[model samples]
Target: MLPDTLDITAIRADFPILSREVNGHPFVYLDSGATSQKPRQVLDAERAFVENFTSAVHRGAHTVAGEATELFEDARARIARFVGVGADEIVWTSNATEGINLIAYGMSNASLGRGGQAAERFRLGAGDEIVVTEAEHHANLVPWQELAARTGATLRVIGLEDDGRLRLDEAAAIIGPRTKVVAFAHVSNVLGTVNPVSSLVDLAHAAGALVVLDACQSAPHLALNLGALDVDFAVFSGHKMLGPTGVGVLYGRAELLNALPPFLTGGSMITTVTLTETEYLPAPARFEAGTQRVSQAIGLAAAVDYLDAVGLGAIEAHEEALGGRLLDGLGAIPGVRVLGPTHGAERVGLASFVVDGIHSHDVGQFLDDRGIAVRVGHHCAQPVHRRFGVTATTRISTYLYNTADEVDAAVQAVADSRAFFGVDR
Candidate 1:
């Protein structure tokens, strides 16, 4: 469902990068799935924080330290509200990749008898299983594989159907008594498939397994409520959500987070330290070791505010409509094969496709030559492409800043690339 209307011109003006020209053509950025172009407001926020409140947080008692601490935690509170979680539930991470690793390593610690009885449920052993999907990004998949390697647990996978949807039947059979964790993507970065979270949640819960969501894609595009989803843990990157690159969010159910062991240990994450032994702090702080990403957090908060001001529903509507245009236009081009979700299916704001008789890099170069920025290659989800029987693809992704005209231009570029490479011949 889209809003009544959106002013594409006015929305595009907020982002300074849209005005950029490439190869003598006006820039048409279609790679938001890889990294979104930042708005001036977010950039200014980062600059303002560094220029003004450049002190370390949670350490000093001085005025500057207090100011920095307040701003940092305030950013957490703001970002927490945007995703419908409590501030304490959100732990700062270097990026979503790190966030997922935190959970996996924390659980590994539990398996090794680190967190005592509090983390017993997180432990996995010989016959135990950790389940993922064929549609997961490597961030969500690889860490679990490493965790399984560390703990002697078996790794199980839910297969994907022909249309790129997860096989719930396979999920029912694969996730059973031994399954200790079930992690999957809220939306496939490659497929644009909005997964049926509730059904998966029910299955995991019924099996007494913890559910971890890779929400790096969903957090920016959808109105997220981690608490409402009842997920045990979730991870999303700030950069993907219109924020800074060095910061990401790891959201855990408060109780679970408190019981979990810290992944990276250092300065501020401890409650008490001695030569003999050390006691760690609780949740957010427990996980946020060392000096925090103060300036980056503030910039992310500003991005959150900007997104809120634009209204997620409106953004969703805008992206959905543009996604429709992307799919329709790309589908119309000869030799272009959309990798996921067929025509008229519900999709988010991205598309990945392959053109017959042309390498994906050649297709990307042709598009790049026309000033359309797209993501080419495996997109960090090799399993998904392998599931679709392709090694790589050309991906066009959208955000609120994108327009239908740009989508058309990208489609035209794809068509032109096909002709230029003689793909249609």
Candidate 2:
């Protein structure tokens, strides 16, 4: 059973934004899938770093620089443990988009004979296949698309089933000898459908392909152990996990990262630079070029610490209960069609829906007027919306702080939206 201290009222108190009123109504933040509101601890961490020990890391020999470097690397180590990987395996990127691009660019370098043995492992050529799913966010999809274009490899995609789950039956036949890399999400950001990752990983490995998991949605809500999952690479953004923006984590097996060449080259990522030749730094340092987001990293480490204190398992259970409430309440509303699984069994707290005879933009605006925030549009997964026969959707995503009362408010707003727009039965 889940712990009783995960009470929503108490959890809500941790977030200051939840107390603020929007047009006299208490703010109901359901847009956590887009970006979560930070708790006081995370905010203070960032401020403390900027105020007390503001200095460039890994460069200066002075006291402040040494302190800053220690704090920065400590943050890296914390994030590494948070995702179940070695500290050296964690590459700090601007965001998950940059992280995915780093992998894609590394593969491109390998194809061009730039990377050594590591490059050979990732090299793609004619007849080699890279597999993705129709449900991928554009960050995951477009990078592979561009990689295929650059490497002269074929890009294949796993289609979704009628219920919006990734169709692994086709994947069995599609992932074959020519397949080089298999990339997909642990959970669909739009559909909220959790994929069978272990089974898919097995299939990909059996076919001699590497797996890259987009864990932007799952890492924030679920208990993720990348080492146990055994994927070659995994990427997630810090902002969605209650940390500041401009920071993200890319976890790769140490050997693979050590073998792959750096994506961005500059000051910090070099071992030695002669006038004529430059030798790069190893692993994480090689990937993290230029001035790192020092304070953001510190804040992200604090965010991980906060989540660990609350317990990810407890958070998941709380979200599942809220997901059940959301599914039931939204299902009963007229002119409302909830996408993905209508039940809570195979889902999390995120729900996407469409209203008959009313545009999603109108629905979003109506809900906002009632102090409810939801994501509306293609949600960066255009192909997924296309599969569901819609151009856009209104999505309500919950977090650890969300309550059953807020879920009810969201459902009521949806009903009110349809009625106000004259789409109600």
The sequence of per-residue lDDT tens digits that candidate 2 reaches over residues 1-425 is: 32474866766778899999887789999999999999999999999999999999999999999999999999999999998989999999889999999999998888998877656888989899999999999999999999999989999999988788877789998999999999999999999988999989999999989999999999999999999999999999999999999999999998889888778888899889999978887898989889999999999999999899888999998888888888888889877788787673477889999999988999999989989999999999999999989999999999999877889998988988777877765
lDDT (tens digit, per residue) of candidate 1 on 1-425: 34455777787888898998999999999999998989889999999999998998999999999999999999999988998889999999999999999999999999999999999999889999999999999999999999999999999999998988888998999988899999999999999999999999999999999999999999899999998999999999989988999999999999999999889999998989999989999888999888888899999999999989888888898899888878888878777889878666667989999999888988899989988999999999999999888999999999998877788998988888867876667
| Candidate 2 lDDT score at position 49 | 96
TM-scores of all candidate predictions against the true structure? 0.98, 0.98
User: Could you tell me how far off, in angstroms, the CA of residue 258 lies in candidate 2 after the best superposition?
Assistant: 0.7
Which 10 residues in a row give candidate 1 its minimum summed lDDT? 1-10
Please give the CA lDDT of all the candidate structures.
0.91, 0.91
Candidate 2 accuracy as TM-score? 0.98
The segments of candidate 2 whose C-alpha lies over 4 angstroms from its true place after superposition are 1-5
Off-target runs (Cα >4 Å) in candidate 1 are 1-4
Error of 1 at 337 (Å): 0.8
